[model samples]
Each structure stands twice: as C-alpha cells, then as structure tokens.
Target: MKSLPETLPDETNALQKMVLDYQSTVDQLQEKLKWYEEQFCLFQHQRFGASSEKCPDQMELFNEAESILDSLKQDDSDLEETISYQRKKPGRKPLSKHIPREVVRYELPEAERVCECGHALHEAGEDKSEQLEIIPAQIKVIEHVQVKYGCREIGIG
Candidate 1:
C-alpha cells in the first residue's frame, strides 16, 4: 500500500485529525490482511503437506491389515520361539532374619476379652506382621502380633 500523503504543517486542525483517523484505519486493515495471508498459508500446508498417518506406499492403505500379517509371517520365520522360562513373582523382598525382633502383642485385656453375649471369648487366631526399625548404629525388627478372639456361643466377637 502506498504511504499516505503527508499533511502540511499549516493544515487546518480538522483536516489533520481526519488524516490521522484514515492512517489508523489503513494500519488496522494492513494488519488484518497480514493475518489472513498467514491463515491461507497454514490452510494450504494442512491440505497439501505430507501427513504423518499416511502410509509411504499409498496403495497399501486399502490392505494394511494383510500387509501387516504378511510382514509378521515373514518375521516369524526368522525368529525363535521360546518354550518355557521361569519368571519370578513380584513382591516385597523378605526382611533379614539376622535382625533381632521386638515382639509387640496387641491382645485384648482380660476384662475386655469377654463377649457382649455374656459368653467368654476364646483365642481364635493371630496375625503377625514385621517392620524393620532403624536406630543409630542398630537395626532391629518390630514384630506386631494382633491376636484374634471369638465367641463360640454368639458366633461373634
């Protein structure tokens, strides 16, 4: 776009204001045109550019599954099939037995051991879990024992 004609130094105030407004409108239009040009370029690229999902051999797109199967068959002939191999189960490794254990029993008191149905609770079973305790210059096992009690009469404890 050609540059706007410069306003004369002695031009009237109204004329100068009109020129300034026209210049601003021209600048805004130019900016909009540049933005439209950029959009056109991007659109052209997207419509015509090489697509990542497109197959290198365009003819194979129709028979992609068959091509894959053929390739797999060819690959299988060159590969060896394993019969058996031992796989270790994933779990937390057991703590060392050498560590001295401090047994902490979580058993119910003698008074509380009685069932709510007036029947005395009997020792059913217990669950034992161990945690490693780290003290300065010393490592020991803290064994937690949760004793279970059951009321045979009410079948609840």
Candidate 2:
C-alpha cells in the first residue's frame, strides 16, 4: 500500500480517524474503570470511608454512589470520576481542672493596756464583740504622744 498522506484524503479518511480516536478513548476509559473497580472492591471488603464503623449507612450509600458513577463514567468517557467526600467533627472544648484554696481561722493575742490608776490590769473575760465593725481594704494605725509636767506630783502622762 502507498504511504498515508500528510492529512486525511477525504471524508472517509476523516471518519476512520474519528473512529480510531474514539477507540483509543474507550481503551483509556476501560483502564480507568478497572482501577475504580479495584478501589471499590477494596472499599466493600473493609472500611469504606475514614470511619466506616461510625457512619455505616452514610458510607454505604456513598460507596454505592461511587460504584454507580464509576460504571456510568466508564461508558461516558468525557464525564469525570466521582470523588469521595467526608464531614469533619466539631472541636471539643477543654475542661478546667483547677482546685481552689481553703480559708483558715485563728485568734489574736491579748493587747497590752495601761489604766488611769497607773497600774497594769490582767485579762478581764474576753474582749466583747464590737458591733458595726467595718473592714477597709487596708489596715491603718494611729499614734498619740502626750507631754507631761511634773512637780513631784502624782505621775501623770
């Protein structure tokens, strides 16, 4: 036979080229179908999605859809293969585990005191509770110094 021309000779040659192109495309589609069939077989035997046990119904439906789409795409080579989709779980909040400090109690020692009689007195029962006591944010102190004049009189200050 003579060497094929650089381009199609006529409409018949063009149709032959189209038929060959279609056959090559079909072969490619067949390969893809084989691969997808292997993938689906793997999916059906064990885990379908990331967590098949958790959402078996949903995963089963998804796998079935994928299988059907694969079959359909094999015939219609132009259509794209179906991709798997998954939903992400919401983030969990961390719990606080801190413990609080307990309150403590104690009594103060008796304060020293001097009377007008110029003698020290021992503890009388206990200091009576003062009513209407208000606690400020901070403690305060007041100092008093008295000047005394003496002419050998009773000790007074």
TM-score of 2: 0.24
lDDT of 2 by residue, 5-93 (tens): 66546688876887788789999999999999998988886765464366547667878999999999788997676769867779644
Candidate No. with top TM-score:
1
- lDDT (Cα) of model 1: 0.86
Q: TM-scores for all candidates?
A: 0.44, 0.24
* Model 2 CA deviation exceeding 4 Å by range: 1-10, 48-157
Predictions in order: lDDT: 0.86, 0.54
On lDDT, the leading prediction is 1
Clashing pairs in 2: none
